[model samples]
Structure formats: structure tokens, C-alpha cells
Target: MNITLKFLLLAIFSGVVHLDTMVFGQFMFSRPIVVGPIVGYFFNSPQTGLMIGVILELMYISVIPIGIKIPPDATAATILSVVFANIRECNDLGMPMSIFFGIIFSLVYKFTDIQIRTLNNMYLSWVDTAKAEFVEKRINLLVYYGIVVSFLRTILFYLIVLPIIYFIVKNVCVLIQYCPVKENFRDIIYILPAIGVGIGIAHFMEE
Candidate 1:
């Protein structure tokens, strides 16, 4: 893939998915179930993407973005998992580790996510304080502001995180290169769905 196109795809996916949640519509498009397949399609590994997405979807089933609660970001994780796992060099080494890294990335992103919302409160305050005649104009400005900031933030994060994570995955892939375990790692992918199901069930039961 051309380097430019690769980065462009990442930018496009992250921005739209992040905005889908942050800007307005609470549509579930940001979820792994949807993101995984689309990611796979783009990476030329539709089956792998679908599997990873479904497993992650099941894993994420228990985490809800209810009022005052911001769940770990799943969009970036799903995209990274599918894309990294499909890498020709990483082979089976990419499957589990990339997904694991992706999940960790999601958790870390939650902190930034909270900060983004906190920053957006600046906009909310503007809306609250504007004079009555200018309130609608302020609200419109804030809406666009929120969307632009959120999109840029997500893109900035990808630019910073992608190379680091890719380097880690690629290096680890080398370490696992000679291991007989490498060939068997694909089975871990098959096993993950069962684990996700268990996690979902246990989460609700413990609740």
C-alpha cells in the first residue's frame, strides 16, 4: 500500500468513527461489529476482520457508554487489530498481540476522550452564557467547533500512536519468528470468541 494512502485511510476511519460518537449521533457505527468488517474489507482480509470484530464486540458488550460514563474507545482498536493481524510479515504473530495492543490502546484513549469532553465543556459554557439573541449562533459555532476539534484530536492521536504500536508489534513478531508457537497462534483467534462470551456473561452475572 502507498504510504500516503495508508495514512489517509487511517485518518479517514478514525475521524469519522470518533466524530460519530463525539459530535452528535449516538449511532452504533463506532462499534467493533461494524468497524471490524469494514476494516477487514479495506485491508484485504474480510474474514479476519469479521472474526476480530465479532470477538471484540462480544468482549465490549458489557461496557456501556451511559450518562457520565465514557467507555474505552473501540473504533481504533478494531481497525488496528484487523489491519495489523492481516499484515503479511507478522503472519500469525499479528493476530493475538495486535488485538491485545489494540485493546490497551482503547483503554489509554479513554483518558484522552475524557479530556476531549472536558474541553468541549468550554463550548457548552459558551452556549450557556451567550446573550439570548446570539445563543443560536453560539450553539451552531460550538457544534462545528466540537466536530472539528474532536476530529483533529483523533487524527493527532493516530499519528502519534500508530508508529509506536506498529514498531512494537513488528519487533515482537520477530521475537516470535522462530518459535513453533507462531504457527499455533491462529488457534488463539478461534479461541478468543469463547473467552469473550465468558467475559460478557461473567460481567453481567457479577453486576
Candidate 2:
């Protein structure tokens, strides 16, 4: 598949996962372990996707959303990481850098989530106004508007972040060619999943 088309599909999938949070479904499609391999499969790199997914899944396994408290946006993180890794063709390095940037993107998405919730609240206020006016159609429109707004948020995020990550990864790859890194760097990547698993086990034991 073309890179642009892959990105578009990823954006749509991320939007659906974002919608799954509240608007339509609560299925675990957004989970890192699930989304990671899926995105990787799109790039014909399911192993890369599965590796990143396992690491992220274990890392964030303990975080749970309660009421208005939002957990980190693991869905966006996993998608971005897999996309970056695939774009850079980092099969040997195991996408360690991509995973790092993915975590960063997840943090950024948390703020986006807050802003989106604020927008949703505004829409809810509009819905209330529609209710007051006794216009059922207006109320329905407002509800649908809210859902569209949520989907747009993911699309906008993709548009903004993807290019930035691409440039950074491209430059970093260029730099790595000049700098001779240790041979064990790839081995380091392999160790991350084990660490994630250990953390997950600890979390489970604590619970």
C-alpha cells in the first residue's frame, strides 16, 4: 500500500478507536497490544507492530480511566510509533527510537484529549439549548456534531504529528549512518519487551 493511503487508513482507524472511548463502542480495539500489530500489518511488519504493542501494553497496563480523569492516549501512541518505525524501515534497530517518540506523542494526545472533552462539553451545552427550544432535530444534530468533532480531533492530530515525526526520524537515520553505534544496540531493543513484561507482572501482583 502507498504510504499516504496507509496513513489515511491509520487515521481513520485511530478515529474509530477514539470514538470507541465514549461515543459508540467500548471495545478494546484502542488497546496498544491490539492496535500495534494491526498498524504494523498495514505496513507489512506485524512483528514490529507486535513488539511495540507489547512494550506499550505492559508499560501502561496499570493506568485506568476513572470518570473525567483521562489516561494517556495509548492508541495514538501505538499508531504513531508503528507508522514511524515502518517509514524509517527500522527492522534491525527494532524501532526503539520510534517507541520513544510514540510515548511522547501519547503525552501530547492527553492534552488534546482534554481540549476535545472541553469541546464535547460545549456541544452538550448546545444540546441542552436545543432541548429547551423543543427541537428534536437540533438536539440530534448537536449530538452528531459532537461525534464528528471527536473524529476530526484524531485526523488533525495525524496531520500535525506525522510530518514532524517523519522529519525527525529521517534526520536521525542520516546521523546514525555517520556515528558508529555499538553492535548491541539491536539487542537493547529486544530487551525492552522483557522489561515491559516484568513491569506488567509487577503491576498485576500489586493489584
Candidate 3:
């Protein structure tokens, strides 16, 4: 698939996943384990997706969005990790690094999530205003408008962030690939998933 098309499709998927957080049924499709392999399959790298998904899934398995606590965006992380791994043709040496970058992106996406929530609050305010000026029939229209805006918030985020991430990861992968100590780096990669599993187990024990 063309890179542009890949990005467009992934962006749409990401948007849908984001929207699924609230507006749609809370399907687990937004989970990293689910979204990762799907994005990986699109790039003909299911193993890469599965690997990243497992690591991320384990790492985040304890998170629960209770009250006002918004967890980091794992779906974004998984999509970006799979996309970056495909772009870099990453093997074991690159996979861990790609996942690390994905974690970072997930943190960044937390801020985006906050912004999206704020936007949704604005939508609620608009709905309140409309409720005052309009009849009961128009209430549904306002609710639908909020949903559309919520969906678009994610689409816009992906469209803007994807290209920037692609360029940065592409260059970083090139630098890391040529680095003389990369052979040693794969040793670190080998341990990362194990560490994620350990953390997951610990979290489960605590819960």
C-alpha cells in the first residue's frame, strides 16, 4: 500500500477508535492489543503488531478510567508503533525502540485527550445553549453534532501528527540502524517484553 494511503486509512481507524471511547459502543477495538495487529496486518507485519500489542497490553493492563483519570492513549501508541516498525523494516533491534517511541507518543496523546475532552465540554455547552433556544426535536441534532465533532477531533489529530511522527521516526531509525553499538542494543530489546510482562503480573497482583 502507498504510504499516504496507509496513513489515511490508519488515521480513519484511529479516529473511529477515539470516537469509540464515548460516542459509540465501548468496544474493545480501542485497545492496543486489538488495534495493533489490525494496523500491523495492513502493513503486512502482523507479527510486529502482535509483539508491540502484547508488550503494551501487558504494560497497561492495570489501567482503569475511573472518575476523571484518563489513561494514556494506547490505541495511538499501537498504531504509531506498527506504522513505524513497517516503515523502518524493524527487526528485534528496532522493535523495542519503536515501542519506546510509541510509549512516548501515548504520553503526548494524553494531552491530546485532555484537549479533546475540553472540546467535548464545549460541545456540551453548545448543547445547553441550543436546549434553551430550541424545541425537544432539535436536542437530538445537537447531540449528533457533538458526536461528529468528537470524531473529527481524532481525525484532525491523526492527520496533523502522523506526518510529523513519520518524518522523525524515519530519520531516527536511519541513525540508529547505522550506529556501531546496535548489536548490543538488540540485547536490550530482548528484555523489554519480559519487563512488560513482569509489570503486568505485578499490577494484577496488586489489583
Candidate 4:
């Protein structure tokens, strides 16, 4: 596949997956377990995707989005982990570093998510002020508008983030290659799942 076309597809995928979080039914298609592998598959790295996804799933099992409260961006983290780990430039960055970057990316991604939500709310307030007779139609229009805006927002964000993050991770990978600790990084990734599982199980522990 052409490099430009590959990026276009990934951008579209990011937008579509984001919809499952709220713009569409929360069927969990955006969840790490699902999004990770699908994204990995697109990159011809299904195993890498699933591994990252499962780890992220365990890490974020309790982060349910409710009301106006913002949750951590698990989908962003998982997708990014898979993307970074499998990228040609980041091939030596290791999964642990990829996942580390992904987690950070997810946190940073929340700011953009907030901006979109705030913008949407501002528009929603306008819709509430529409004349009575056409209010219903206006709301319906707003719903469609919100979906498109939300979708485009993610794609644009992905386009901006992908290269920047890739560049940083690639450089970091080069700098860390000769570090003694780098040899043991794989062990950390191996241990993360256990820690993640503990975190997840603790969420359900009765007092």
C-alpha cells in the first residue's frame, strides 16, 4: 500500500473507532481489545496489536466514561501503542516504550477531546435556543453535525500526532539502544500485564 494511502486509512479508522465511544452506541468497538488488533492487522502486526490491546484493556478496565466526566483515552493509547511498535522507524523502540508513549499520548489526547466536547456543548446550547416550531429539526441537525465534527476532529488530531510522536519515539529508541537498562525493558513489558491485572481486580474488590 502507498504510504500516503496508508496514513489516510489509519486516519479514517481512528475517526470511525472514536464514534463507538459515544457518537454511536458504546459497543466497545473502540475498546483496546478490539481496536488494538484491528489497527495492528492493518499494519500487518496482529500479534503486536493484541498484546498491546490486552494490556491496555486490563490497565483501563475501570475507566468507564460517565456523564460529563472525562475518562483516560484507552482507545488512543492502544491504537498508538500498536502503531508505534509496528512502525518501520520505531521497530527498535520496543513494545514497552511504545506502550509508554501510547499511555502518555492518551493523556495528552484528552485535551483535544475536551476541546471538542466544549465546542459541541457550545453548539448544543445554541440548538436549545432555536425557535420552538423547528427546534426538533434543528436538534436533529445538530446531532448529525456533532457526529461529523467529532469524526473529523479525531482524524485531524491523528494526522497531527502520528508523525510527531513517531519522530520522538524513534529518536528515543536510538538514544536508549546502548543503555544497559534497555536490555531489561522487555522484562518490564512482561511484568506490566500482571500489574495491570492487579489494578483491574482491585477495582472490583469489596471493601
Query: Which structure among the candidates has the greatest TM-score?
Result: 4
Which residue segments of model 4 deviate by more than 4 Å? 89-93
For each candidate, what TM-score against the reference?
0.91, 0.88, 0.87, 0.93
Q: Which of 1 and 2 is the better model by TM-score?
A: 1
Query: Which prediction has more favorable lDDT, 1 or 3?
Result: 1
Model 4 agreement with the true structure over 68-182: per-residue lDDT tens digits: 8999899999888888887665454568888999899888788888988887767776767788898889888898998999899889878888888788888887778767876
Q: Cα miss at 107, model 2 (Å)?
A: 1.3
Q: Sort by TM-score, best first.
A: 4, 1, 2, 3
What lDDT is reached at residue 128 by model 3?
A: 61
**What value does the lDDT take at residue 15 in candidate 1?**
82
Residue range 1-207, candidate 1, lDDT tens digits: 874578677866778887776576869888889989888888778888888899899988888778998888778788778867866678866878889899988777788888988887666777677789999888778778878888888888877777778788888888888887677776888888998899888988993
- On lDDT, the leading prediction is 4
TM-score of 3: 0.87
Q: For candidate 3, write residues 14-102 as lDDT tens digits.
A: 88887776668888887878888888888888887888888788777777789999888777788888788776545555677678787
Cα deviation at 28, candidate 2, in Å, is: 0.2
| Model 1 per-residue lDDT at 124 | 75
Q: Where's the lowest-lDDT run of ten residues in candidate 1?
A: 3-12
